[model samples]
Target: MNSDFLKYQAQTTPHPLAMEISYANGSYIYDSNNKAYLDFVAGISATPLGHNHPKVISAIKKQLDKYMHVMVYGEYIQKPAVELTKLLAKNLPSSLEKTYLVNSGTEAIEGALKLAKRATGRSEVISANKAYHGNTMGSMSIMGFEERKQAFRPLLPNVKFISFNNESDLKHITKKTACVILETIQGGAGFIVPSNNYLQKVQKRCNEVGALFILDEIQPGIGRTGKLFGFENYNCIPDILVTGKGLGGGMPIGAFTASSKLMDLLQDNPKLGHITTFGGHPVIAASALATLKEVTESNLMQEALEKEQLFRKLLVHPLITEIRGKGLMLAIITPSSDTANSLILKCQEAGLILFWLLFEPKAVRITPPLTISNDEIIKGCEIIIDLLDEIQQQ
Candidate 1:
């Protein structure tokens, strides 16, 4: 299987963690060899309820029995999609009452960017430095990191960048700018959280310039950051809120929400501005709706904070310089990139899953499932700490 994967599959990174999985249950992922690997990263923060969650699976199964893909998104009034969007609207602010569902986070971002341009009638888009929105062309254009995006040059035009958490950079957003897109808590950049009311200040600047403020909550939203959305924690309500990871209960889904007035713009002037055939597939919507319900209604959101505290308490070590970000969205910063790489690979062999951020080579990602137990948290942290000790002794 590994050989076939290497031969047939198009490679993204040269070195892939080729752990052939048999199945997963809760916070445990079983390899083809039947070895249980503790899930510490939760499929890169995509599986909020962990693997094979009963409610999510049941919802998917139920939806499958009823129906699957009916028609393109926004054409058919699918119950699952309607209910999911309604629930989202009820939870979000009154201004954000409409949602455009899509296949992945990148697609959601693309749609948001288009909507922003259409609504504001401007072309300039500003993104934060070291931000990772998605991999699509428009998303790639706004990506602050140049090294990875250099090869895919000639992306969208008139896109600019600002230093995240730096209030002084807010001045760059002018009336000519369509939108300022930022992650509520910047992911892939060492899980950098917004500080000193940075998000609020950005929104203020966007408002002053009549530019839309779009918040990419793909990594930090969906109850991962204590609040249902990370922007809520910072008191920054964006014009467009994009979400994806963990919203689908292990399925693929993404959505961008905006006010009815702004979202309506996508429909007119170009009858079908943005269309997706499988955006709101019934099975996916059912799974996502169930995930959202569980995250909001159950104690999982609150438990995330408790588990975060446990992680911080147990991850104490000389090698671990600092734990960045909040709630389940966290990054353990090591003293060196080599130390971070060694810990991630060694922890995998030690039966604990760990990952790295995109640009921050010295930061180890620790965004486990929100449903991960305290015992699981302690065990994973112990493995990490023991490995650090071994590395230090060497």
Candidate 2:
């Protein structure tokens, strides 16, 4: 199977953590050898309720029995899609009432960019440095890191970048700007959290310049940040809210929400401005709806904060420099990039799953499932600390 995977399948990276999985449940995944590996990455924050969650699976099964994709999004009134959007609106701020569902977070970013351009009649777009929005052409154009995006040049035009959390860079967002998109908490940049009301200040600047403020909550939203949306924690609301990852409960989905008046712009004038065949697929929508219900109704959001405390309290070592981020969205910053890489690989070998952030080579990702037990937290942290101790001795 490993040989076949290397030969037949295209891979994003040369060295993939090719774990032949037998099955996964709760906070643990069983490999082909029946080795129980404690899950701390949660499929890179895609499975908030954990793998094969009963409610998400039941929702998917029930929807499959009823129907799947009926028609393109917005054309058919599918119950799952409708209920999911309605519930999302109920939870979100009033300005962000209407949602346009799509496939993957990049697509949502694309749609939000289009809407901002359509509404503001501007072409300039601004993003933060060291930000990772997505891989699509438009999203990549705004990606702050030039090294990763240099290969895919000739991207969208008039896109600019500013230093994140740098108040002086707000001068770049002029009246010609269409939108300024930022992650509620910069994920790939070592789980960096906004400080000194930076997000609120950005919102104020965008408002003053008539450019839309867009927040990409793909990694930090969906009850992972002790709030339904990370923006809630910062005391600022964006004109456009983009979410994915955990929102689908391990299923593939993405959504962009804005005011009804703003989203309505995609309806007429141009007519069918943005269309997707499987954006609101019934089966996926059912899973997302169930996930939303569980996250909102259950005490998982509050537990995320408590779990974060547990992780911080337990994961104490000399090699560990600091832990960045809040709630379940966290990154353990080691002294060096080599140390971070060693820690992740060693912990995985020791029956614990740990991963790395994209741009921040010195930061080890620890985004576990929200449903992880305290015992699981202690066990995982022990493995990490033990591995760190071993590395320190070397």
Candidate 3:
């Protein structure tokens, strides 16, 4: 099976972990050998409520009994899709009353980019340095890292990048810019949290130039940040809001939301300007609705902050430089890439699941599930600290 996977499966990386999974529950994943590994990575922060969450599974089951993928998006008014959109509208800021759901985060980004250009009647898109939106062409086009995107030349033109927290760089968002896109918390760029006054200044600059501000809350949305969205902490609202990652619990989904007046632009310019076949999938929508309800109504959202405090308190060592990010979206920065890599591999080998950020090799990701218990948090942090100590001794 491993050989078949290696031979047949398209290789994204030269080497893969090749860990065979049996199943997962809560914060743990069982391997084919029945070894339980503490999953701190949480499927790259996709599984918000954790593996096989009861609420999510029950929702999927209930939806399956009723129906699944009944029709293409925007054609038939599926109850789950309608209810999910309505729920989003009720929770979102009044301006962001409409949503365009999609199959994944990248698709939502593509849709949002199109909507931004069409809504503002501009072509130029600006992103931050070291930012990562997704892998699709439109999202990849706005990616600020050149090394990763060097091969895919001649991408969408007029996409520029500015220093994320540098106030002076705000000037680049001039009149011709269609939208200024930013991750509310820069995920792949070492999970760097935006400094105070940075987002506000950017928003103000966008207002000055009539450019739309699109916040990518893909990684930090759905109560991961102790807020419904990361922007809530920054004291500002974006013209466009993109969400995915944790929204579906363990299901796949993404969406971009905006004001009804603004979102309506996508309808007229091309009639069916941006459309999808499975964007508003019923089963996925049901799962997302259930996930959102749990995050909002239950104690999970408030516990994120408390769990974050626990993680920070326990992860300390001489090899550690600093910890970046808010709530559970943490990145433990080491002194060098070697130490970080060694610590991560050792942690994994010792029955823990840790991961690396895409560009920042010196930081280890610790984004566990929002449902992880206090004891689980302590256990994971202790494992990290233990690995750090062993690495230092070497």
Query: What lDDT is reached at residue 111 by model 3?
Result: 90
Clash count, one per candidate: 0, 0, 0
The CA root-mean-square deviation of candidate 3, after full C-alpha superposition on the true structure, stands at: 0.9
TM-score of each: 0.99, 0.99, 0.99
In model 1, the runs with Cα more than 4 Å from the true position are none
Across 173-260, the per-residue lDDT of candidate 2 in tens digits comes to 9999999999999999999999999999999999999999999999998999999999999989999999999999999999999999
lDDT of 1 by residue, 245-289 (tens): 789889999999999999999899988888999998899999999
The segments of candidate 3 whose C-alpha lies over 4 angstroms from its true place after superposition are none
> Against the true structure, candidate 3 has what lDDT?
0.91
Clashing pairs in 2: none
In candidate 3 the C-alpha lDDT for residue 106 amounts to 94
Candidate 2 lDDT: 0.94
Displacement of the residue 324 alpha carbon in candidate 2, Å: 0.1
- For model 3 the TM-score comes to 0.99
**Predicted model with the maximum lDDT:** 2
Give the range of the ten consecutive residues with the poorest summed lDDT in model 1: 68-77
